[model samples]
Structures are given as C-alpha cells and as structure tokens.
Target: MLTNVATVIWDGLNPFEFGAACEAFGLDRSNDGHENIPVPAFAVCSPTPGAVRTSMGFSIEAPHDLGRVAEADLIVIPAMGHTTPETLPDGVAEVLWAGYDRGARLLTLCSGAFALGAAGLLDGHECTTHWMYTDKLQRLHPEAKVIPEVLYVDAGQIVTSAGTAAGLDASLHIWRQEYGAAVAAQIARRMVVPPLRDGGQAQFIDRAVVEPDTETFGSLLEWIVENLHEELDVPTLARRSLMSPRTFARRFRAETGATPHAWITGQRVLRAEQLLERSDRSVEWIAAETGFGNAATLRHHFTRVRGLSPQAYRKRFAC
Candidate 1:
C-alpha cells in the first residue's frame, strides 16, 4: 500500500543517505517483471523549494516544497550535518509530525533520527541512529529507547536506522514487508547489494586496538566462519584458541561484542539464508548443512531470528 513516497532534503545533507532513500523508493523498475507491484510515486521535497547545499560542498535541488510530504504515504528524513535537536530547520518538525499523525510512516536514516526526536515523535518509541551519535541521541532524548547496535529498529509508524549502508538494509526491510522477499531481492539485485544481511552494527564497531606485534585470534574467527557446519561450542573453540574456556569466552565477547554461541548461530543462520535463497534444497538438507542438526531445530532458530519459517523464506526468496 506504500504507493507514494517523499524525501525531505535540508541544507548540509549527506548525499549517501539521501541517495539510499532515492534508490529504495524513487526508481521506476517496472520493466523488470515487477509490473504486479505498485511503483511508488516518489518526490524530493525541500523546506524552501530550491537548491540545497550538501555537506560535500555541492548543491542539489528538489522538485517540490514541504507541501509534497503532506500527500505522501511515507516520508523519509535523510541524515544531515546538524544532528542536534536545537538546530532543526523551521517547520521541519511540524511537517514530520503532521505526516505521522495522518497515518503515514516516517523513516530516518542515521542522524535523521535526531530530527524525529526533536519533533517528540520518538519520545516513547524504540529508535536508533549512527553509533557515533547514539549516545548523544539518548542524552538529548532520555525518554526514547535508543538501540545502538542493530541495523534498524521498526517501531510501528516510525523506523530508524544505524549509520550509512545500514540504510539499505532498513529500506529493503520495508520493501520486504510491503511486498515480499522476492520483490526486495529483485530490487537488491538491481542495486548490486545483498538482499539480506545477518547480525547487527556491533560487528562493525571497532574493538580495543592491540599492538601490531601482539598475538590475536583473527585466524580462529575466520576458521569459524568458514566451518559453521561443524560443532563449535565454547569448549571446542577454547581448545582451538589455546586458552582456557573461561578466558576464551571473555576475550571473544570483548573483541566481538557478542558471545561465541551468539556469533556462531548468527553466522549459521546467515549461511542458511543464502542457501535457501540460492538453491532448491530441502529444509532438512539446509538444516544439517548449517549445523542446526534437524529441521525442527532449524525452524526454531530461524523463526526466532528471522520471524519466518525456513519454508516460507524459501518460498518468498528462492532464486
């Protein structure tokens, strides 16, 4: 039902985030066997309807003014240079509130969540922003629950995402929900990006820097990823790492921001998703291949992680 989309542009906007919105909603891909799907009427709107300067020292012009948002079924706020609540442009908050109050979904990419917070729209909702700004967003809006490590948080009518490329993940999530995984995959194919990604922003966060000469566990992590089908419990991994089980667990958590089991399971699920999408294999085969032991166990884990059964995922996304 998301047939109309509008993106709001402001001065000093980040071009990458703005382009993410446009790539997700603005392109007309009807020629790609997607005629059954509704092509959203997309527009770019500005506060004053003129050339808007970007953070990269360039300017881009939007075709419409703030009024365009009033007619959209969804409104997108791209990340801008000024993320603080006190620096919002005139009437931007009102426009966001009006669109949300009228039953339209509001999406923010990265620091754009700050604008939503400034509008008081995120006060009681779960939201997120770029990791660099997560602390500031929470400090500015104590009432909002800020989840810093996820790709995006979908809180009913308001959707917020983490930094940069996570915007694509969030946008594909919306597409998958509105249409289906097939449509999202098709769009992703056109964009030359993965249709689905596992885990969260925590994987991208920088860990404590070790000295260049210090011995690390990089090879162990790579081996785990390459052999997700094997048994990789804490004791086995600890033995492989040449450390005590307790010490290995502590060090893994510190370096990865996720426990060993959680990281391994996430990688298995990611592999299962790829297999489900790319091959015509049975659930039982995929379960065993991904180290889930059996179909029921795979279903339990897949459902808990992806909110969809393995069969349903294959049906929606199989190539």
Candidate 2:
C-alpha cells in the first residue's frame, strides 16, 4: 500500500543510515533495468529543499521539503548525532506528530526513535533503539516499554529499528507486510543484502556458551553456523562446549533465548529460505546442505515454519 515515503533530515544526521533509508525507499528506478518491476518507491525530505551535513563529516542535499512528508505514504526518521538531549530544533517534534496524526506510517531508525518518543508516538508502544541508547530512550520516555534484544519492533503503525543496518531489516519487513514477500525479496536482491533477517535473532554477536567475564562464543557460533550441514544434537553441541547436555541446554537457552533444537531448526529454516530464493538447487541438495537430512524432512519443516511449500516460496520470492 506504500507508494511513497519521506525521510526527515536534520543537521547532524548519520549519513550512512540516512542514505540507507533513501536507498530503500527514495531511489527512482524508472529506467534502472527495473523498468518493469513494481518498485515500492520515492522520498520527500524535511523542512527544506537543500543540503544537510552529516555526522560523518560529509553532506547530502535534499531536493524537497517537509511538506513532502505531509502527502507521502510513509515517513522515516533516521538517526541524528546531536550531542544534547535538548538540542532538537523547535517545531521538529510538531512536524513528526502532525505526520502521524494525519495517518501516515511513522518509522524511526536507531537513535531516531528518540524523536518519536519525544513526540509521544512511542508511548505505550513496545520499541527498541541502538543498544547504547536503550537506557537513554527509557530514561527519557517512561511510558515507552523498551525492548533491547530485538533487531526491530513492528507495532503496526509505529515501527522502530535498533541500529544502522537494522534499518534494512525493518524496511524490508514493512515491504513484506504491505506488498508481499516477492516485493521485499526483489528489493533486497537489488541491494545485495539478505532478503529476510528475523527480528528475533541476536544482532551480529558471539553465541558461545561462556561466562560473562571470559567467554568468547562469537567465533564458536560462527563455526556452528558454517558447519550446520553436520548432524548436531544436544549431546554433540555439549561436547563441543565442554559441558554436560543439561548444563549446555540451560546455558544455550540463557545466551540465545532459544532451546538448542529451536535454535538449530530456526537457523536451518533460515538457511533453507535463503537457498530457495537465491539458488537453483533441488530441494534435496538444499536440504542436505542445510542439515535437514532429506527433501521430505526439509519440505515438512519448511512448510510448517513458513506456511508455504518450498516451491511456493520460490515462486513468490525468487527472481
């Protein structure tokens, strides 16, 4: 349903993330070889029709103004690097509130969540921010329930993402809900990023079953991810972690919030989804590589988790 999007900009915006928003929603594809593709498109900038400086010591100019947001389908707020809590300019909050009241979708990227919080849009909403600012957002807005573990939280009309790259995942999720997985996948493919990153997965971090003081589970988790093709059960995983099965399961759940079986199945399903969309391999081949043992097992679990057969998913999301 989103045919247009608007990005709000300010003096100290993070250019990379601001550009990510533009890249996802603002880019014109009329003649970019996607001439026949239905792009979920376009941006209208904030307050002015000129350039804005970024936190990265660079600048980008907008071709439009905040009025553009008034008429758009969605409005995006990207992170601003302003140093003081009270430094936000006069009327910025009003602009945001006005947009939301007018029934436009309001989304915030990372620290940009603060702006939404300030306007009371996030009040009583389950939301998240860059980990570093989770406490700050909470301290600043007591009514907002801040969730730290999620990559993004979609409270229907109000969406907020954790940090820089997480904005990609959030944007794609919106695309999926509005346009379907096919459009989301196509947009992701054009960006050369993963089509789907579950909001529940831990952000890029180590997953080793180690104590807080000396554990280095990141590398170990990477090894597990790479070797997902091997048969892995609790006993085998416990052996690798040098713990008893019960102890390992307890610790793994504590660390990842998922039981070992759930984690493995989720990862395998995620891998299968990627393969289904990105490769021409047979179900048997993908099943073997993703540790589902055989095509039948893969099909069963894939359909169970995704509510679609592998062929159906491929037909919808694959190029």
Candidate 3:
C-alpha cells in the first residue's frame, strides 16, 4: 500500500546503502519485462535540497527539502558513515518525528539507524545497526534494544537494517509485505539477487567462531531447529543437555538471549512461515506439523508473532 516514498539522506552517506534503497523503491522497472510490478512514487529529500557529498568522495543532488517528508508513505534513512550524537543533521529529527507520528513507516539502512536514535524514535524499540556499531548505538540510545547480528529488525512503524547488504534484505522484506511473495520474487529476479531472505537470518558480524556446544548451545540449537515438531519441553531439553532444568533455563537464555519456550515458539513460527509460503496445506495440518497441536493455537501464536493470521499470511506469501 506504499504510495509516496522518499529518502532523507545526509552528507557523507554511503552510496551502497542509498543505492540499495533506490534500487528497491525508486527505480521504475515497468520496462523490465515483468508484469504487475507495483512502483511507488519516489524522491530524495535532505536538510538542504542541494549538493550532498558521499563518503566515497562524490555528490548526489537532493531535489526536495524536508517538507517533502510530510507527504511520504515511507521514508528511508541511508547510512551517513558513523553518526554520533553531535553529528545529527539540522531539523532532520523533527521531520522524522512528525513523519512517524503521521503513520509513515521509517526505515534505516546500516548506521542510518543512528539518525533514528538521534530522533528518539528508537527508544524501547528492538532495533539494530551494523554489528560494529551495535554497542555504540545501545550506549548512545540506552532505551533502545540493540541486537548485534541480525539482518534487520522490523519494529512495525520503524524498520532498522544492519550492515551494508542487510539493507537490501530489509528492502526486499518490505516489498514482500506490501506486495506479495510473487511480486517481490520477480523484482529480485530483475535485480539478479536472491528472491527472499527472512530478516531473522544472521548478519555476518565477523568470521564464524568455533566454540564448544556446552558454552554456545550450538549443538542444542541445531537439534532444536531440526525437532521443532516434537515436544521440546524444558525437562526434555534439560535431559538432552545433561543439566538440571533450572541450569538449562539459565544457560539457554544466556546463549540465545531468549527463554527456551520463546525461542522454540519463534522457530515454530518460522517453520509455519515456510509451510505457508510453499503449500496450500490446511492450517490445521500445518499447525500439527509445526507442533502447535491445533489450528486455534497456531492462529493465536502466529497472529501474535507475525501480526497476521495463518490464512492472511498464506494469502500474502503463498505462490
């Protein structure tokens, strides 16, 4: 349902992230031989609608000023290198605050999340930035829940992406939600990128670390993912890990940052999402397949977690 789209960019912006947003939303691909590609109106706005230098020593012009944000259905903020408290652009925060208040979704690419943090929009939202900047974002916006290594966090009205490539992931995610899986897939094909990558996919914060299963819960998490359809109660998992239930609960939270039940429910919801995307199976069957026991329970949990019912999700994502 996105109509008017705009990017509020700043000086020293990273071109790749800005380009990622542009490629996803700004470009007119009607001539790309794809049918039913919904294109939204696009613009680039800035504090000053003039020459803006990029981090790579080049400049791009912003054709519109901050006033244009008031008409946008979605606003993008691409990375401006490493932004701190002092470097927030003049009058940017006020416009973003106004935009969010008016129900326009705000999306931040990479360290552009710092701009949202500056605007106080990230307060109490589970947002993220480039992994290298996660700690700093949390420190600066202490009220924000900054997760370090996820591709992006979609906080309903605000979506924040991590790292460089994660911006593309976020962009495609928005497409999938607003359009449908099929349309987003066609767009991805046009762009020669993967069709879809769920936002929960991990960001490559650093090279993988090899650690013992006892410390990292690496083996346990793998097993949990594989056996999501089975009864994954705490006692059963505790026995599998050769620890008391209390110790297992503490360890599970320490390693995964979610309680055992919550993590398992999240995994089940992901499994449900995959099933919804690939098949026309009945919700009752999918619920049992994903260990939700019945359609009503599945509906309850899926609606709570995904903000849509199983049927609605299938309508949006099923091919």
Candidate 4:
C-alpha cells in the first residue's frame, strides 16, 4: 500500500535528517538493475514551494507545493533543528491529520515529532524524538507518551526516530514491513549502513551502559561488570550493596534510570555483541560467558535488543 512518499521541507532544516528520508524513498533503485528493490514514488514539497533555507546557511529549492502531500501513502517530517515547527504551510497540521485519517503512514525524524504533537496526532500514542529534547517534547504535549533514550518508536502508523542516522533505521524498519528482509538488507548494503538496528537500543549506549554515576555505587557497579558471568539477581546485589532488597531497587532506579536487572542485562548483551564480533567462540560459550547461561536465553534477549540473532549478527558484523 506504500506507493507514494512525500517529504515536507522547511527553513532551518537539518540536511542530514531531511536527506535520510529522501535517500530512503526518493532514489530509483530498481532502475539501477536491482529488480528486487521496489522504488516508491517520492517528492519533496514545501509550505511555500520555493527556496527552503537549511541549518547550514544554504538553501535548496523545493519544487512541489504541499497540496499533494495529503494523498501520499507516506508523509515525512524531518527535524528542523528545533522542537517547534515554524512557518509551516497553511493547514500543515490538517494535511497531516488528513493523511492519517486515510491510513497513510506518517514518519517524523528527531524533533519532527513536535509537528505531529502540535496537530494532536501524538495524543495517547507512545512516540519518541531525539534524546536531548525528549523532556521538552513531553512537556509541550503532556498527553503523548514520549519514550526517551531509544532509537525510535513505532506506534503503528506513526514512526518517530532519534537524532542523526537513527532516521535510516526507522526508514528501513518501515521498508522491512512493506517489502521483505532481503529487500531491506539490500538497500541497507547499498547505503553502507548496518541493517536492522532495533528501535529499543540505547540511544547513547556507551554512557547508558558503561559510565554510570561514579560518586555512589562506584565499586559495587564495577564489581557487577567484572562479574557479569556470575549471578546478578537483585537479592545478591542488595546483599553486596549492604542494603535491603526494596531499598536497593529504589536507589538503583533513582540513579541508573533502569532497574538493576535491566541494567545488568544491557551490560551482558553489550558484552555478547563484542564477543560475537571479536571472538570466534561458539554461541553457547558466549552465552555462558555473558551470564545468559544457554543459547536460547541469549538468543531471545539479543534478538530483542539488537533485532538480529547472535549467529546472524556475527555473519553480518563479525570481522
């Protein structure tokens, strides 16, 4: 059903976000002898239908008017380097709502979700934006469930992404739904980016996993990392931290933003990714080493967080 894609451009646009949507759909990949790749009809439209200024102090001509966007099968709103959309065409919100009403898929990259939020499209839906402005987005539209620190959120028809290249991940996710995994993988290979980065990945992985607050629980957290191969249940951790289970759980969530089990699982999966890339060990060995204990358990968690099983990830990413 995704046939035509229309992207809305405006002044103060971030070229990277704008181009992510354009590159995903606009290019005629099938014409390049890639017969399996289906190219959707793509066009760039503007509120004013003329010179659109960019964040880099330059301008690009937008040839089409926004009038046609309401009929598009997919509508894109890229980040404008700000949360609030400014100087949009007349009835832009209405146009978006019309598309939604008719069953068109709407995607917003980074701060572009703000536009949908203004239109009340995000109400009662779990959506996301760039991590830096997630709090502000939540404040502006209190009814929308804004998930922060993840790559993207797919609330059925409405897809929202984090900053920069996360847009490609969201676009590929949509393509994977419309087309097949083979087609999505081919496009990802052509684009020279990793295919199938899951939406739930930590937006800031290293900091979110490795570098927790050092002032409190410094040595305790370090011990957990060192002993990822050992049992890391809450009771064990609570005993080690010298606090009761309930108090430890509350304190852990207060400081780390994730429960102890969730935090420990993320670290183990991170280690599993590294081992899968750098070492030639078997999946069972890696699983045991990362404290998952068995292949099935490791596969379940790894695929949930990474969107690729350990064996598949090794095939694609192993060096």
Candidate 5:
C-alpha cells in the first residue's frame, strides 16, 4: 500500500545503507520477476536540497525538500557515518514527528534508530540497531526495548535494522511483508545476500558469555566448536556439564539468546564458511568435518540459511 517513499538525507550519512534504501524501493524492478508491479518511487528529502558532506568526507546532493514527506508512505532515516542522533539538524525531529503523525511508517538503518528515538516514535516499541551500538542505544532510549540480538525488528508500522549490511535484511523483510516471501527471496537473489538469517544477531556475537563464577559454559562452547565433527547434542552436552537437560536449556538461552540447536546450527554454518573460505576442502569433506553429516545436508542448510552455496561463498570470499 506504499504509494510514495522518502529517505531523509543529512550530513555524514552512511551511503551504503542510504543508497540501499533507494535501491530497494526506488529502482524499477518490474523486469526482474515482478509482474504487474509499479516500482515505488523514492526521493531524498532533506531540510535543504543541496550538497551535504558525508562522514567519509564526500558530498552528495539531496534534490528534494523535507516537506515532501506529507505525500510519502514510508520515510527512511539513514544512519550517519560519524554522527550521533543528538546531533541531528534543528527541525529534523519536528519534520519526522510530523511524518509519523501523518501515518507514515518510520524506518531507520543501523544507528539511524537513534534519529527515530529522538523523534519519540520508538518509545515503548521493540527496535534494533547495529550490534556495536546496542549498549549505547539501550542507554539512550530507556523507554524503548532495544532487541540488540536480532537482525531487525518489525513493529508493524515501524521497522529498524542492525548495522550497515543488515539494512539489506530489513529491506528484504519489508518487501516480504508488502509483497510475499517469493518476492523477498527474488530480490535477495538479485542483491546476493541471504534472504533471511536463520538466527538473530546474537548468533553473530561472541557465543561465550563472560561469567564471574560459572566458567563451565564457556569451556563447553569452546569444546563444542572444536568437536564440530562429533555428534554433540543437548542431552550429551548437559551430561558432560553435569547439569540436567532442562537446566542446561534455560541457562543456555539466557546466556546466548538462542536455543542449543540453533546455536549448534550457527556454529556449524560458520565452520562450513571458514572451511570454504580458508581451505581447499570439497563440500563433502567440509560437511563431514563441519558436522552436517554429509554434503547434501550441508548444502541444504548452507543454501537455506546463507542463500549461497558453499562453492559460491568460497568463490566470493576466497578472493
């Protein structure tokens, strides 16, 4: 139901995610497997339409004025490369607040969530931002529940993503909601990122949480990674730690923000990635060593989770 979309441009913007927002909705993709679809028009609206210096020291022009949001369906506030949300230009917050009041969906990429928070739209809502800014975001917006461990958070009308690359994930997710899974998947294929990540952003963080007293979990996580080729299940892991399965499951989720099975799957996928990129291992042997049982199993999960085969990943990363 998006008729028009807009992105707020300002100084020090991260061009990658800002440009990604435009590419996701601005570019005409009708010829790219989307039939009878009118490409959503995108415009860069700023407090003033002129050249603004980016954090990279390069300048780009914003051609439209911020008042254009009145006719827009969605508005994107892109993260600044070297700026904090508190440094937003005067009147920018008022413009964004007006847009939100007019029923426009407020969206942000990475640290862009701060702009939304400043606008008071993220209050009492679940949102996410780049993992590096997780602590800062939570501290800045105490009213908002910052779900730092996820790729993105979709609060119906409002959506936010973590980090720069994760903006693609948020964009595709929006496409999925507006269109369908098939369209989202197709767009992801066109862009060449995983259509969907299997686990949350937590899976990408350091799995071993630091505990003052209980160091068993950290040792167990290390053991699990080293023994990826072995059959290490929850029951077996719990037995090794001398804790009951139920106790282990609860503690693990609290510590890792994911279940035992999900954690293992992520580690296995990561292992496969390492082998693919760093070694000259065949998919069959890689699967066996990465604990996927066989090449077919490896292919199934790798392609499903990563949206790229092991060979393709190697080809891309090995270079």
Candidate 6:
C-alpha cells in the first residue's frame, strides 16, 4: 500500500544516508522478475529546491520542494550536520508536522532524528540517532526515549535509525512489513547486504580494557560469548565471577545495560544466526549447539527476536 515516497534533503546533507533512501524506494526493479509488486514513485525534495551542498563538499540539485511531501505515503529524512532542535531550517518543522498530521509515515536516518525532535514529532516516541549523538538527542528532547543501542526503533508512524548504513536495515524492515520476507530478501540480494542483522550498536561500541581492573567482567563476557553452548544461568555465571548471585546480577546489569539472562540469550541468538547463515545444520542441531536445548525453544526465542522462524531465516540467508 505504500506507493509514494519522498526523500527530504537539506544543507549539510550526508550523501550516503540520502542515497540509502533513494536506493531503497526510488529504484525501478519491475523487470527483476517481481512484477506484481509495485515500486513506489520517489522524489527528492528540499526546502529551497536548488543546489544543496553536502557535508562531503559536493553539491546536488533537488528539483522539488516541501510540496512533494504532501503527496507522499512515506517521507525519509537523511542525516544533516546540525542536530540541535533549535537550528533546523525555517519551514522544515512546519512541513514535517503537516505531513504527520495528514498520516504520512516519517523515517529518519542518523542526525535527521534531530529535525523530528525539533518539530515535536518525537515528543513521546521511542527514537534513536547515531550513537555519538544519542546523549545530545536525549539531552535536547527529554521527553523522547532515545535508545542508543538499537539499529532502529519502529514507533508506528515514526521510524528512526542510527548511523549511515543502518538506514538500509530500517528501510528493509519497512519493505519486509509491507511486502514479505521474499521481496525483502530479493532487494537485499540486489543491494549485496544482509536482510537481517543479528545484534545491535552495542557490538560496535568501543570498550577499552584497562588490564586487571576491567579484565574480570570483560573477560567473563568474552567467555560467555565463546561458550554459549554451556549452561549459562545467573548462578553459574555468578560462580564463575566469584561473586554471590545477588551481587553478580546487579553488577552484570550495571556493566551491560541488560540482565545476565537477557545478555546470554542475545548471545545465543547471535550464535544461532551465524550458524544458520553459514552451515547446513538442522534447526534442532543448531538449537542444541546454541544452548536453546530444543527446536521449539529456539523457534520461540528466535521468532520473538528476529521476526522470522529459523527455517525462514535459513531459507533467506543461507550461503
């Protein structure tokens, strides 16, 4: 049902993020054998409708203005340099509000979430920006729940993603929702990217270890990741850390921003994803290897976390 798409550009645009929106929705792939699925009519619009300089020192012309957003079913806002709520252009906030009021979905990439926050669209929503700006975003929009760890947050009408390449993840999620996994997979194949990524921005965060001080917990985390096939309950992990269960649980949450059980489950799921993508193992074998015990348990947690069953995921991502 999503047919009309518009990508809004502005001064200080990041070309890669803007190009992500164009590649996702603007390309005409009707002759690629998926004829029944219709490609959306796409447009690049700017507030000034002229030469817009990018952050990388090049200029690209936008032929349309804010008027194009009015007819769009979805509007994508790419990353811009100035991310403060007060520094947005003159009428960009009004135009965004108008589109939201009329029921158009808004997808923002990286710092573009700042524009939505400035327009008050992110007032009560769970949103995100690039990891580097998440603190500033939270500081600026105190009302918005800014989660810096995830690739994207889908708050119904407003979808926000982290840095440049994560825009592809969010865009493919939209396609997977509107169409199905097959269509999304085909598009991802054409783009030479994975249809689903396992973990989140937590995997990309820089965690420096300062010898014996940080080595205890950091080493424990690495051990858990390596030995996901073992029994990794809180008590076992606590014993391994030489702390009481109660103390270990609190310290684990403080260190990882997640409970021990949640962290272990996430690691198990990530291991399962790697096995599914690389090997020809059966689901039951993979479940046991990842410490899920059985196929049903694996299916339950995998479907809840990845939005697809093990078989379906293997069918799409297996090499």
lDDT of candidate 2 over 1-319, digit per residue (tens): 7877878887888887787898888765666666634554576475656778778887788777766667776889898752233766666677777877777788888888987887778889999888777888888889999998788888867999988878998998787656556566678888998776533435333453233321634555677789889978999988988889999888777665567787788778878877887789998999999999999999999888666788887877775
RMSD of each: 4.7, 6.3, 5.8, 8.2, 11.1, 7.0
Overall lDDT per candidate, in order of appearance: 0.85, 0.77, 0.84, 0.82, 0.78, 0.85
How far residue 285's Cα lies from its native spot in candidate 6, in Å, is: 18
Predicted structure 5: lDDT:
0.78
lDDT of 4 by residue, 1-319 (tens): 5689999888888888898998899888877668867778888888788899999999988898888897699999999755444544467788898899999999999889888987789999999887778889999889999988678888888999887788998998787556545566678988999665422435264354343455777798779889999999999999988899999988787666578888889878878877887789999999999999999999999999767899987886664
Residue 284, model 6, lDDT: 97
Q: Candidate 5 residues 62-174, lDDT tens each?
A: 99888887778888888864344568777788878888787888788888898888767788999999887888888878999999888888886789998777788888877
* Candidate 2 deviant stretches above 4 angstroms: 28-37, 82-86, 198-319
Worst 10 residues of 6 by lDDT: 207-216
Give lDDT tens digits, candidate 6, residues 89-108: 77788889988999889999
User: Candidate 6 — number of clashing residue pairs?
Assistant: 0
**Candidate 4 positional error at 100, Å:** 0.5
Tell me how far the alpha carbon of residue 134 in candidate 5 is from the true structure, in angstroms, after superposition: 1.3
Better of 3 and 6 by TM-score: 3
Off by over 4 Å in 6: 207-319
Return the TM-score for candidate 4, rounded to 2 decimals.
0.66
Clashes, model 4: 0
* Tens-digit per-residue lDDT, 33-143, candidate 3: 765787889999999999999999999999999998899999999998666657888889899999999999999999999999988899989999987888899999999
